[model samples]
Target chain A: MFGAEFVPLSLPPLVIGSLAAVACALPGNFLVLRRQALIGDAISHVVLPGIVLAFLVTGSLGTWPMMIGAAAAALVAVALIEAIRRIGGIEPGAAMGVVFTTLFAAGVLLLERSDTSSVHLDVEHALMGSLESLIWLDGTGWGSLFDPEALAYLPPELPRLAITLTIVALLTAIFWRPLKISTFDPGFAQVIGLPTTLIGLGLVSTAAMAAVAAFDAVGSIIVIAMFICPPAAARLMTNRLEIQILWSVLFAVLSATTGYILAGYGPLWLGADNTVSAAGMIATVAGLILGLAALFGPCRNRAGAPLGA
Target chain B: MLLDAFTLGLGYNATLVTLGSALLGGAAGVCGTFLFLRKRALVSDAISHATLPGVALAFLVMVALGGDGRNLIGLMAGSALSAVLGLWLVQKLTRHTRLAEDAAIGAILSVFFGFGIVLLTVIQTMEAGKQAGLESFLLGATAGMLKSEALTIAIGGAMSLLAVLLLRRPMTMVAFDPEYASATGMNVSRIDMLTMMLVMAVTVVGLKIVGLILIVALLIIPPVAARFWSDNSDTVALLSGAIGAVAGYTGAALSASAPSMPTGALIVLSAALLFTFSLILSPRRGLVAAALRQLKYRDQVHMRQGLLAIALQQPIYERLTLNMLGKQGLLRADGVPTDLGRARAAKALLDEERWRALRTLPQFEAAAARYDGLTDLEQILTPDQLTEIDAHLNRPHGVPA
Candidate 1:
């Protein structure tokens, strides 16, 4: 399994998926605590329309315009949700529901209206993400790890996701105090001179950044699953935010690695030839982890926890 | 072709799709009202996405059993089962774990859908899956739909609509005031379950028409739009049904008129169009109505402040106030009050004096609270009460002394 073909086929997707999963999971800790997990879901869904609009505007499947379009869409979705909630006096959840669904439906309609068969732009591709096809074509074996020549040909998502994950991690570590304070008690944080509103906005913006970067690699399913499952399972495992962050990172890496392995080889073990969707398998594994945590984790119930009650 | 489809002259299958989608829309709208009222509208989203795995599973199972996997009822049943499981998992997480409801919803939504996507890939690899058309459930496909399937959807929609009508009273009561309903010998939780089940049924039934992803739109957009037209729950429910029906009919017709038009997206877009119109045009709560009301109030304030300035012989500096007074012939171009302006100013002064006197009386306390400077004293106070207050006014202070 560690032969020439394995490094070429499996290493890049695994690393990219793991990096993307961690990228989503880091911000997810704060979001799950703040009861804003759905914002990730909403942001991911609205990215569809953004990319579709981008494609129609530029008439190319270039990654930068699509990523920019997705980021703009996320911002638009957030602004729209806020606008609808304020103007229509609609609840936040319902407002988010209306805005994201409308945008996603519009994306679907546009995709159908425009001719996209020649490009790799189907709803399935958009949803499942061709993670398996993101192969390291130039690598020969495990020895390619030290080869700068082979490294130069690595999929762009690896570097992009690494940067995104680094930025998200740095943000988390740098603002750990304010994030925890605001997530726990906004009024107290405000009384103490913390910019609670800006802090909240920054947190959401960070999550959006993570979501947009991870979307092209693992798809929205893993983005959403990583956002909720790892942190949620981590939340159940411990009371301290620091330890919870550690646990969440651990869980995210585990889910991505195991899920990719299972998706690629689990069917073979069961005597089947075809592989399943890695995005789906990753999400399922994350859910299974969360389910296990919910069932047997030390702090699963809300006896002493004050977060997300 | 589009016009013929809209007029229900497109043929039997197209007509069936249009009418069935309308009935489903109406039912979804009415059922969704209670969900929106309860502020858990996205619960339907989780349930809708949860149906995907069951669809693939149902197809796989049917194909294994030596029958075609295109049975509408079996697919619906399978989807319904999974949606219920998803709903149950959400409820379990919310109730049993430290997870908030929204987190539970997100968890269930993504995870179940991810699992479903896996199943879809699995089915795709199978021999029978080549023509499975399972992707239709993702975004419904209406082309070459069988008669039996259309009839099943129509009958299913009508039954759910009937069920919604029968249960709207209790569901509305629970949604509006759950504690009160629970105290008044109603099972609020059971009613909530009923609401979820109805939403789930609509979701499963709608899978072939509106697709799972946008089914929540049919349930959500109509009620939200209807809310602008009325505050009364009953009116909103009925009106929501009507709006949803219209959107459904129009969307299905449009989908049939073109080759590329998707039924679900068109349906959602139609509903969103109605929502946009309602947001702008509804007489009571719409944006235009709110702006108009504000404008009327602002104009009245300007007129009152301008009139007060005239009564006191104060120079009117604000342009809007001056313009308003001039337009009413209350002030001249030289900023002098016309005779009509002066007379109205004097009456305004007298009304202010009457209000001041009334505010001092303990018996007129409730009436005094209604005072805005623009409100006519005569409108709120009866003539007898006004006379009593007027009797208490300072004895004609001579020449503004």
Candidate 2:
């Protein structure tokens, strides 16, 4: 199992997928609790234009530029939703619908018109992702962890995802108290001087960061699925917020590992020669987990429990 | 060339596709009005997104069974099955969980779409999968649509229209007030299911035309636009259908003319344009119209107050008010109220005093009904009666005047 082929070809994707899943799921718990789960979906769609525009201007697929572009796009999406709601007097969901779809359409048109072959960001990859192709072979085996020479040659996506997951973990740990109070009861939190608005913005920005970091590795569909599914499933399984977070992390890891393996080798067992999309499989597995949990979870009858209770 | 495109001289394909889109728009608009009224706009989104897996699975099964897998009916069956399942899941989640409707919709939409992507990838890896043309269902490809497909859409649209016609009264009743409808012996849930089935029909047919991503706009924007124009449900539904038709025809024509523009996006943009126009300029609920009414009311109030001041021999606030009143024949231009102006000013003063008294008195709350019935000027309290009530209310508690 620890052979050279296994370490390079298979290990990287599993690790990358798992890291991406964990990164997204951490912020997703907050989103699900706040009932703003769809904002993750909207951010994923709206970031397409930002990524494309960043590539067009910089003429490179560098990580920092793409992340910056994605962040700007996410901000624009949130701002546009607010503006549409206030000016047009439309509901928030409808405002989100109008903004994200229009932005996604604009992204598609721009991708079609521009020269994006150099960046490897085409329309298909924008929607489905190119997860199968992210392979890493710097050195051999577990020993390469300490070898600086080997680390230098590692796949860029690996370290990017690792850093993103770390930042997400650090932020969640730092703001854990405020996040819980503000998300559960903003009025009381504000009355107690908890800076509820800033906490809310911080949470949204953290979700945006995770979305952009995972954009190239697992794509938006998996980002959206992981953001909602595991947390939602975990939510069904537990009542305590801390326990829910633990369950969510566990579910995210399970889906990412199992789904990737299924996508790669499951088809062979079914007599097919080629493997399927790892990102799609991961999402499907997450959905399956969520469906099962919804049916048999601990909180099935306690569905009407108050938020954050 | 522009004229040719405008006149639809491009040929039969453009004409057929345009007509098919028009029919779809009309049906979706009618179904969407009920959905919107019931505050289920995002439910359509969830249903449409959920159809993706069904479509891909249908294609795969058809191919596995030794067929080309391009059969429209097979694909539609798969889509309808999944869409209904998605709606059921949404209903269950909302009913059984602490999740709000938006969270449930968001969860179902992403998960189903993700599964669809998985199936699509699986299909992609199979032999001859490239020829399946399954990807077009994501964003739509109107140019590739055949006349037969167009005909199928038209037939589906016609069925939805017929259903709405047959169930108009009950549908409206349920949409407006389901509790009342149920009290009146109508099966509210069954009626809701029937409406959802109609919406599912339109949504499934619309997938090939507008695609999954933008189809909800076709369903939502038209009826919302029509709402600004009419108070009657029937009129709003009719106007919604008309607007949908226009949007479909124009969007298709523009797509045919400009070859590069995506048909679905253009259609949604057209609908958005119509919605913006209605929001700003509609006569009943539009911002511009409401603002004009406010300005006119302000002018009338100013004129009335100025005329009262003059009749009571008090100070005139604005000099132009007296001039405007005289021009309107409410004043004699001699800085004194004419006979008509005097009567009008006294009535206005009396009505103002009565409202003030109504606001300050706690015991007179029951007299609100009397005040509502006294809209006629002759029925208003006399000056002496108004002064007596004012003096009585102004005294300290329990002190009789």
Best by DockQ: 1
Instruction: Please give the CA lDDT of all the candidate structures.
Output: 0.92, 0.82
Per-residue alpha-carbon lDDT of candidate 2 for residues A161-251, written as tens digits (9 for 90 to 100): 9999999999999999999999889999999999887898899999999998998788898898889989988988877899999999999
Model 2: how far is A111 from its true place, Å? 3.6
- Which 10 consecutive positions of candidate 2 chain A have the poorest summed lDDT? A300-309
**What is the TM-score of candidate 2?**
0.84
**Which interface RMSD values do the candidates have, in the order shown?**
0.8, 2.3
What's model 2's interface RMSD, roughly to a tenth of an angstrom?
A: 2.3
List TM-score (chain A only) for every prediction. 0.97, 0.95
Fraction of native Cα contacts reproduced by each candidate: 0.79, 0.39
Candidate 2, B1-401: lDDT as tens digits = 55665577878777777777787888888888888777777788889999999999999989989998888788989999999999999889878866667767877887888889878888887786877888888877777677777778777777777776677788889999999999999999999998888888888988887788778888888877888888899998888888887887777777777666677777777777887798789987788887899888777767767756865778675777867788877777566677787787777776666566665667556554465422532355566655656675443565567
Candidates' TM-scores?
A: 0.95, 0.84
lDDT of 1 by residue, A98-210 (tens): 89889999999999999998898878777888789999888888888899999999999899999999999999989989999999998999999999989999999999999
Top candidate when judged by TM-score against the true structure: 1
lDDT value, candidate 1, whole model: 0.92
